[model samples]
Target: MAGEPQPSGAPTKGGWITFPFLIATMAGLAVASGGWVSNIIVYLINEFNIKSVDAAQIANIINGCVSMFPILGAILADSFFGSFTIISASSLISLAGIVLLTLTAVIDSLKPAPCENGSTLCMGPSKTQLGILYTSLALSSIGVAGTRFTLATMGADQFDNPKHQGVFFNWHFFTMYAGTVVSMVGFVYMEDNVGWGLGYGLCVAANLIGLAIFVAGKRYYRLMKPQSSPFTRLAYVIVAALRKRKVLLSSKSEDYWQETQAEGTKFVRTTPTNSFKFLDHAALIIHGDTNSDGSIKKQWNLCTLQQVEDLKTLFRISPLWSTGILLSTPIAIQISLTVLQVLAMDRHLGPTFQIPAGTMMVFVMLSSSISLAIIDRFLLPTFQKLTGTSATPLQLIGVGHALNVLSMAISALVESKRLETARSYNLNGNSIVPLSVFWMVPQLVTVGVGEAFHLPGNVSLYYQEFPKSLKSTAAAMVSMYIGIAFYLGTAIIDFLQKTTRWLPNGINDGRMNNVYWVLTLIALINFGYYLICTWLYEYQNVERKELSKSSPYPC
Candidate 1:
């Protein structure tokens, strides 16, 4: 009864019945997050009077924190609170942050005096003002960290079939991008045209609505119970292996300790594999390692073979995971830099409509949304029909890597052309160039397509391959690397500003094209490293012979 599959459309706690509520909530939160985050660069410049490069650096730090904090959220969910509790609490926290942010927009005392148009002199925000802004950003970022990937994991948990889970991931990203598109296009326009206060107010409303929708669907959720920290088990495995470092290896399965079931019940025993053989010592049946009844005497000294293998699995996949950090770093740099680029370029569309500088990112989101639809609806099915197998996650990631490299190259070329135009017009020192902002569309769309390929591929691979005990944490791994990438991007920008002349206070006064070239080189090198890692990597879950028969696309 425990493992039996629920009939389709049966009265169940989790299934397609929960889809609409989850998707709606995801879209709402995305709109809320995008409203403030997408426009923060302009807000700092116009409201707080911060310099452009400084604001971008600050934004990068905030992005890094938002991306990195998800691991802590995942840990809390996996070890103590569970997804439902964490998401609910986080939504409230996010609402509080947005309220504070809106207050900053409405209250003149909360920000600095605006600089006169074309005036070089500007008043910086006082310490108190900056403190309030930082606090609000911190709270909002923490809230986002908790809900973003955890929602993906929870949505996937609603279905037992891998194909269903894959489809859910596709829709999850689509809804997220769709919501971001709305915030970037709609809310950003309001912030630029109507008022920042009204724009932030909309974010607060969206957060409240999303939270309400999530709560309303509580009855249909199949919540996973919190397990004690999976990381603790991993630590125990490492400790046991190191303690038995000098012990001889055993070739026989009986020499390893396996976790047993209820008394007198039969269970399959897991034996340590030859890969990462040193860790097998943790599971070796030394004297005093087990009680007379065959239970573990000390967890710190004797780990189950299954635990050993879980640690080994992490070791095997970590190289691939490291590749994602480098891959993401360039994109993070591009995102912050692209906003600056848009600000300096002509944004007028037709007669009365001038594109919001912040809304340039909408192109990336829109491209990703469209590409996801095509990939899910046409590309995957077509690939399966032709080859009798769906495209592997590694292959998808590889394609993303190549596209990312090309995008960086294109960004460099575009930046070079923008600079040439600026010099031709004698525009300098933060002056806007006559170049159309649409010149950036190609690079933005390329990166968006790359994200559509890699983001889901990375998540699907991590979720499918990780041990069951670490499911939530597995989903958060992608966030962790992305966080690291953002930090790395910030660090690189800071170093370039301090050491090189490429990035200055005014991007037009510096060689911004060179920055794109550097990122392009970094991406190219990272792709080569990724190819090596993928070459050495073997599938632990998706490519299993039995599973291959059930689903062409296990991931």
Candidate 2:
């Protein structure tokens, strides 16, 4: 298979493909990326002399960029270059960013001088210095987005079997979470105890190594050819549907345009589903819509019924996807706030060992990792056995919502207790509360459990439900939700700061309990909305099964 004819960079269709190379690259990149990102808030505050809340906001913005660009990456992979080219290029970009970040740590001139003790005034980074920092963040964030989700598609491309694909996805997530844990614990500890220079230098090395390993396995990867943009087809369907809005939809399948190779050959045709009947107009054949040979006359003004229905399918699933944004927003808020809480609480495990504030998120990642295994191995199978049917994605999402609401309540309670402890200890200003940081673990674990249920469920649902042509976009939708949520979290924090005194620079002064209460209410409301949407939604693949069983076309 390796000797078979193929393009210069692409491997043959059949061979021992290098999926492990992709996985290893993903793991290394994940570690390097997570190391910097997880501790960015602390770095900005301690080194760059930014305010705590401002640093958190900046971190959220960076996270938003990282999450958002994957859609663009997916589009580029599907329409222009394949995943291999994109990943290679993005990895190089990331390495450059990490190198720049390393410079800020190594060179004292690149950063503002450390604040003097008992000084109220501290100098922030100069505009030029900030520009350099922001540039590095932009490059690294975009680079991470490009490689992370796209690699999932590339790895799955290596396998022909659905079972193999499922296994790959499981391991992909496992490696991702494990890498995150390593960065959050080991790398963050190094940054806190040793030096930022050493920590960031390690990140640069990891990225370079990941890139080198990826490039070395060039001949062992199964590459997919780029196709024409599916977005264009979707646009044509919309334009055609609007142009033919008054055209009556026919019950007979013959009236709709089905694909044919030539005059005498016909393709296996699917009848448009009864849902979204208005979109069916796009497929209704008008006298001037097609050529004599049955090709489209005006590319933008005419489309097949299948094309129109494909657009409708996207429309159907959109509300459900929007629910994920709401689901993630509170989780984002929790992560940032949890870090802030750790900063203000007793993080010491013993007389000597103290946990880094940035590393508190380890609880969430740890809980999520374990929950993933339990959900896959025990919970899902038991549920299926009890019900005599596998739980639908919607049901899994509903479970997640319940757990999130509970988690928010727990967060509120913990904060309330912490606030009481602060008050009791006379810790009014710049003093850590006497409360133990372990109080945050339960809420973090709860949210992690919610993530374990909904993250995979949402990804699986989108991948299964989206049109075959839009599979890359489907995978990217999850990233879109997370990106939007991070931005939304930032906005929510800003809003609270402006409107209320719930989130001051110091956690000791701020009424964080109220913020958690607000999030809990919102999560509950969002859950209700999700439930209504779930009730209203119907699966779109029934027609495909029916079409496969019996042809709509007459002989």
Candidate 3:
């Protein structure tokens, strides 16, 4: 039985057959995560009696935490446990967090009483209550960070062909967006109309179901075992380079350490390129650095040429990564403020139904989901045909920046219009302004379209350009950018609030349009910085492949 193939109809290790299970798990987790996060501002303001601005700030900080922690999760996945184990364990943690969050909604003692209608003063939550709430949020945020990008890497692992991986990535975003749409619209509606407890209870159920489905499909996964930590090697390279800093440089490739076959693997190592020549010293087989079999005699004294180059590659790419942080900060601020904008505007569809403030984010998700398909299927192909080449990732990101700048301008104009309407009505004291919430849609849609370009573009660029040792880390790099952006945006907002009257407790009395204008100026400057970085950068892998295939021209 051990040697035999058993049954003709038995399931295989990995194939298209695993798609349904993977997608179902993704959807369930997305719904669960979105259910809590999409409505957090409203939940805090209404149920916990927090100020609107303060609630948005908390939401941004939480978002930053969720995005940033993924780097640690990815490191753990690539260096120790594989993605499946991390995903399973993190789902359980998230489920526990959701259960606690649901308890806060259900138990009267967990939250302060609701503010009376038309009353400005409300009791703040006690330290004990705030402590429990924050603990629950921290758990869920950590849980989300563990699973988000890790699942994409796992699904990509199932496919050997790069084309198949590309297709899977598209479906990953699609499923994520679809789930977010459901949670933002349906779950948010439940929270606004029925009760927060029921909505959060559904989140708990979704997390449980997602975890179960993932566990059930364990046999079908193509799990990658963790090797020694890549970060450890990167650190070794830096240390070795500094130690050999006084040594003379060499132009010859033969002087550096490269494997005929990489240790413990059969694949031949590629020759080191000429870039970042200073790092070549790390691989120089200087006196007392290596043993008889060419093994390193001292861990901190010698590293392979590939490892040094890997560190250099990260250094070269970092400026580009920093650009994304600046690009995303404005978007983060816009997202947080847009919810508050919705609260102050007319949300009616007709006489019977009104849009929930949280549900408006569904437009961004919907735009991204639909726009992704169009870009992948139609836009990119058309550009490739007309230009006789595929658009590079940098080019795609450039387009995204242009779109984002446009979105910011529109946001400023729309806010100005809303504020003008408020002044005309002399309704500065009223909670609801006369402006339609739908006016906010153009900016959201534009931001979504920009995301459709930049997000996948960054993922593809990192995956293609990063050294083979750091694939999972590459995916998390995108998360790191967004995380820093959120936190930085929080700092900027707090700073502005403390220094100026542009953002007070209420928006109607504040110059929100000026904030948008400031964001627009920052975005434009960041775009210029990105252009310089992209212009100076070379694609290491792509350039080498092109060079190897090129023939010398005859005189």
Candidate 4:
């Protein structure tokens, strides 16, 4: 009890230390796997003699599912399994998958033989040889998605005390980016030279090492117990909605929609409340409990359903945040699509001077890293001074979305130039795009702008929307939205590719510039939607009060 968090298993200094280590491990494994995965596309295309777009789509489809699978993990974590167990177990599952993937590289499928040199895990002769490869990828994705939310909440448990809360968040984001930096550079080079098997093997090793670190500090983690399934509450909501619908249509149901006038979350009615009173779902913006001296104090009180329901609550108040997920969908493309655009199309330099396609990731990494650092070093303080408190995270979100919109337009036009150049010349070998690569700098820079806005806002928003106990689940909710959008984005792209003739049959011959132009148009629409939702995004209570003091009202 002495070391345990107040509401959970005993907290110890060890748990806190172990908690971050596990998280960092997770971060390293996730991003590093991603780095290798990106390079793997080049290997698959070269090794198998597949088309470029085919390789791109294969990568896209597999990763697209990563975001959506977390919901299953969240559901189980919220109900049957606690965070610690799920994370550890999932990591083990993923580690197995990684081993199988490495084996594929050495073992040959044809004639029960191996690769030219005869290895154990190398692929077989046909496209079917990749089936096991895909399975391994799926397993890793499952492990990652399942444990992602489980561990994040586990980490937040360390800083529930208000004093360390702000610092905890700042460090959390920092550690995440730090893990990303290491993986991006280290994994890419390894995957490029060694076969896919060894590169993937390294990723498994990273995850396992992180898991081992997590085990050492397990005593300090302050793991919370699981709760009842959220489906029950969702069922409750459905019944309530149905009952309300009947009442509304029958002209007697308005009372059903009213807030439980008593403050308790759930209360059954003997009968509908009124002859004339209409339920106001939007009204009664639930006020906080006040102390005897007029100060406000916060309490976290809820069940599994209540915790999960908070996502709906978050959506209600921060409609923009939910829609903001769509705006962010392009980001998943940062590694795959944007990389393709730069390497395959950008025409700024001649063949001799063109940057190696893989090197383009440096720009993406630079944008995310430098932009985040600048925000902390300069941008945050400058905004704090100028807007006082009113310039909130939501305000930054609007600015970020604006940048996303701008970048899309730039990519459409500049990338188009590269395509035009290639089409005009008969040169097939060592073909490079034209003046468009220079324009990538601005688009890439804007990626940083978008990151600075969305990352903090999403984190803070998820944390603020839920009670402290359910913070992890809330984080899952945020991630799930992104995941769903990601899966949807890939499916949409695939459907378009097959249904449309815009893409030529050759591997390197995608109408990439046209594709980006269409995406640019979509970004503008997403920007408009984000703008509409901006009025609803909120800041955390502490930040809100501090900002309230400013002379002008902005947030």
TM-score of each: 0.91, 0.91, 0.91, 0.75
Task: Give the per-residue Cα lDDT of candidate 4 at 448.
Answer: 71
Work out how many backbone clashes candidate 3 has. Answer: 0
Tens digits of lDDT, candidate 4, 66-119: 666777776777688877788788878777766766676656551123335322
Give the per-residue lDDT of model 2 (tens digit) for 321-407: 999998999998888888778888898999989999888888888888789778777887787678666666667778999999999
In model 3, which residue pairs have backbone atoms overlapping below 3 Å? none
Instruction: Give Cα distance to truth, residue 138, candidate 3, Å.
Output: 0.6
Q: What digit string (tens of lDDT, one per residue) describes model 3 on residues 375-403?
A: 88898778767866677777888999999
Task: In model 2, state the lDDT of residue 202.
Answer: 89
Q: What lDDT does each candidate get?
A: 0.88, 0.84, 0.85, 0.57
Give the residue spans of candidate 1 off by over 4 A.
1-20, 156-170, 246-252, 261-271, 377-390, 471-474, 542-555
Q: How far in Å is the alpha carbon of 25 misplaced in model 2?
A: 1.0
Better of 1 and 2 by lDDT: 1
TM-score of candidate 1 to 2 decimals = 0.91
Instruction: Summing lDDT over every window of 10 consecutive residues in candidate 2, give the lowest-scoring window.
Output: 546-555
